[model samples]
Target: MNDRTDAGGNPGPEQPGPEPTGPEHTGQPGQGAADGLARRAAAGFHRTEDGQVDVLRTVGGVRGLAESIVPGVVFLSAFTATQALNPSLVAALAVAAAFTVARLAQRTPLTQALAGLAGVVVCALVARSTGEAKDYYVPGFYTNAAYGTAMLLSIAVRWPFMGLVFGFIRGEGTHWRGDRRRQRAYAAATWAIVAVFAARLAVQLPLYFADQVQALGAARLVMGLPLYAMGLWLAWLISRPVAAAEGPRV
Candidate 1:
């Protein structure tokens, strides 16, 4: 009647907007599916003697840790000694390749080896393309940015990535979201990891801007395992209740 609505009280054409394309508008992977995935991941994974998450065991352990650090160390050491990009990149690649071969020869799982090699390859390519030593760390910076964003999104959606990953890794699938308490626990753990990723970017992004290759490398080395270990411990502690608590949120 006021030039916008009809006599029946329906609104008129002056307010017609586009249709919604949000989660409610689409049949995307909703919280229900995410819940299932997380449940599956955590099913078989039980706490250890030290009360650690079971999925934490299969994550490359000491060997995976070694594969992750050696290449960066080699790269930094080579560059420090020679003050050149090519040799340093070459050394990093060599170490990655050698690690791959060792894994293959030892008949150990090559997932970690291959992933380390791939990361080195990408970093070397970036450094070479830019002809700057600091650019070598660009890939890792972008990786942190991407992962941090994804973690934030996952938490925002109430389907925390930690729940999904642990569900799969623990091979128990997920029902954590069913309980408000467990849901909060996993969300906190997920955010802890997100903090680690974000902190890396926050610290290293400055060094990258300054082109302080040594400082960047040092930060990477220091923050890499130590920071992640802290996050892991935090996650373990948060999830301890999941193992001890009788059931989901109820």
Candidate 2:
């Protein structure tokens, strides 16, 4: 049959208009990178409260990660090599000090470097005082326990620490806590942190008390970064939707 036509035998209305054009919604620049980073970074999913995936706010980059990891690694390696506490402590301390000085000289933020230094110094002092290689990890143990307790208690009181911290940073004050849904979401996120801390204690404390310094160090190393990243992911998962549900109003 002949093609359908108008009364004048012209092409029919079924002929399509020019292909639509303009900014695309799906293939936006950097979208693939954002998606990859969100899913892959630290082997966890991370995003912000705006329902947009991005880097986990908790994780620092390569240099910052190095600052945290290197000193501990040095301590573990030195102790394993020398089978002596003082030399290992000195090695870690020296590495931490070098990081701090490098940060200072570069005029960068001293937070991570100084934190590394303080941690090493405290562990060293503890080991020195206790005369045991294992007690070098004591401060970290108590720290995890304290944080775990505080976060769990905050959840019990219906004021999760994640909510408090996020709100303070956003200048939203305590208002988000007033929303029951948001509060519940934050509480879930807080529970993630509590889990992390609890896991650390459960894994590391036995090794600590057993004087298994190397095993404790290994546990701390494995748990610290990866678990913190997971907590960040949980925060984004639980809290972002709450914020999104509230919409852009506040």
> What's the TM-score of every candidate structure?
0.76, 0.73
Reference-based lDDT, each prediction: 0.65, 0.61
- Tens-digit lDDT track for model 1 on 103-203? 78998767557777877888899889999999888877766767778778989998887776554443323555666877787798888878887788789
Alpha-carbon lDDT of model 1? 0.65
**Clashes per candidate (backbone, < 3 Å):** 16, 0
lDDT of 2 at 61: 55
Top of the candidates by lDDT: 1
- lDDT tens digits, residues 1-250, model 2? 0000000000111111112122321445564443333222123122357634333333545675576667778989998888999999999999989988997899987765666677778788988998998877777777777667877888888767766554433333455655788788778877877777777778878898788888988776767665665665666566654336546532
User: lDDT score, residue 186, model 1?
Assistant: 75
- The candidate 2 region of ten consecutive residues with least summed lDDT is 1-10
What local lDDT score does residue 9 receive in model 1, on the 0 to 100 scale? 6
